[model samples]
Target: MKKLLIIGTMPIILDMNADSSSDSEEEEIGETEETTQKPITCLISHDECYVAPQLLNELYVEIFARVPCSEYWKLQFLNKRFSQLLKSSEIFRMRQKLGLVKPYLFLLSSGANRWTMFDKDFESFLKLPKLSSNICFFNGDKEVTSVGTQLIVIGKEVEGITVWRFELEMQKWVKGPAMITPRVMFGSASHGTNAFFAGGVKIDKNSYEVVSIAEKYNAETKTWTAIHAMHKRRKLCSGFFLRGKFYVLGGQNENDEYLTCAESYNEVTDSWELIPNMLKDMPVLFSQAPPRIAVVNDNLYLLETSLNELHVYDVNANAWKKLGVVPVGAHFTRGWGVAFKSVGDELLVIGASSARPQSQSMTVYKCRPDVEEIVWEECKRCCRGVRLNHFILNCCVMLA
Candidate 1:
């Protein structure tokens, strides 16, 4: 007879075949298996505290202290062991990053879609270039005729001379050629490592013009070439990939007047056609909002400045509704505000305080699709240690 034991206590008796091994041999086999049995252990600590129990808790602290809540939540679900370490100082920070908890919004102003962690509210983690304001980024990718990890940002130093680049991973930004003319506030979308930059403001000392010229940047070649220019010029437009096409939405003209119009660019035809205006019959109600747009659950949301009311519009439905609004003084005036979806269908607004351009604030707002009033709150603790450059909310995964 062979017997297996666990915890050096209870034994599991195994009857060896009578025709097989001797009793002594069977006992040896049982002893070997018993020794190899894995013992159940708690994630926190073990007897005598040979190792510091704070290590796991400290890991919990360090990770959340460094990363955002959305990313941290994903890591937590990687294994049961990680989720157990939720009791730590960084939990609140993670919650703040993820929009799980709230109070003071985090804001850092440099440019949208640049990755940098700040140590103070007004100072930035990245060294600003002489023409940092002239640069903007576009997301791109390769494979599947769709966008991937490619990025595009440009600087217009002198003349209407604009330059763009592609990112290799999130760490590097490779430069490309100057555009035919200098442009800013352009819209760019990706189709597999190639990003199309279109519809920006072209500047040439003492005057600026709305432009419709479109250009494409190839990540592999690190080169930018001209594509067809659109018929109309637009500035501060929203560009995104949807249903195999690049959609450009409502933007302002040269006079700073909002235009309730939209257009789509087709790669195959190298043409742009007027699509239905995203906000038809919707009058421009606020000056500060400046046609801010964000996509959530495949539905597009247009935020209005009047009382910070958020209007939800279905591009497919051609319909609209008041989704929610943020409290007054919580957001910056004339700041670039963007929305990011969290791990739990939560929506976060990334913006800088117009009151103070250098200070950035991240507002975590709950989405109430069915309710009349949407609740917006700020995460005080998460932004406590972080000073400037905001929370990397829009550009963390992207290269600046």
Candidate 2:
């Protein structure tokens, strides 16, 4: 039989034509030839000298963890192993453990049931699954929060309280447990496996009544438990969980007046304590829209809707310090419809700005938090020449 050794693009042929009468004679001849013959040398090209080492399953998982969530589905076509590995929760667990998980911005446009996601790493937009039914939209009063790896949307429909949970791995939405009360324009925050809902206005008759009711939903148990209500009725407020407590700040009261007071709820004691006002002299107004809040590090950031100013609440100092005004286009109206979320170390603000005489443009600003000077830089510009009035309904960040 002929023997061939492929060292590069070139193939080397070896002669193995020697014959022997017996096994002993053949063994002796082979030994003599191997000892006396000079080894053939071949020069291999740089591209064909060595092949890259195949990645181990564990290494592949680590690499996949850094990939943006929007691109995960497209990677399945590479091979079956990738499809299986991408589906496994182990990769995401590794991502979370290694701190490789990045926050993905999910935007829900008004007057449309479909959702669009913005991936900061890739700087691209992706359309997510549409709402299964029209009941998912709640006249721009829906509240959204993230619990673990799932995105939960809470709102009221004609039928009753509607809740939907979007499983990140499955990339689909499923019916979640209904709320005990059908509320709108409420404040919500999530910690661990539970989500806390705070004060909001509910329709009593023809007029709207501000309610101080509060509740927490357990994602694991799929049940709701009533928590201690806030001291004052609040609607269009911002709620967030920080340092083992839920804080609700800055909203309109029963008289439809803007509020500057803030409060925190301690679940361990089942009580709400009044905290210092976010602004000492000025009131936080949300007449045009709800205030936006994001938690970065241990500080809570509040974006005033009317003034377009950024304020940070220091947990240790127990004081609010003015950051800086976000740089929206001059033609924009008082930051009324801007959406805010914290992605990694940067704060992302998205909204519509005047592009031309009659058209609106979508703009995204990335703001860095600093005590001396917090600066806002334009990161993305989209939806040009399109009317984005009331189009951006809600925005939230999901770590993936």
Top candidate, metric TM-score: 2
Where is model 1 more than 4 Å wrong at Cα? Answer: 1-151, 158-160, 164-174, 205-207, 254-256, 283-289, 327-346, 352-384, 389-400
TM-score of 2: 0.70
lDDT of 2 by residue, 211-240 (tens): 889999876566789988889899987888
Worst 10 residues of 1 by lDDT: 138-147
TM-score for all predictions?
A: 0.54, 0.70
Please give the lDDT score for candidate 2.
Answer: 0.66
Candidate 1 — what's its lDDT? 0.48
For 281-313, candidate 1 gives per-residue lDDT tens digits of 665544543355555455566666544666777
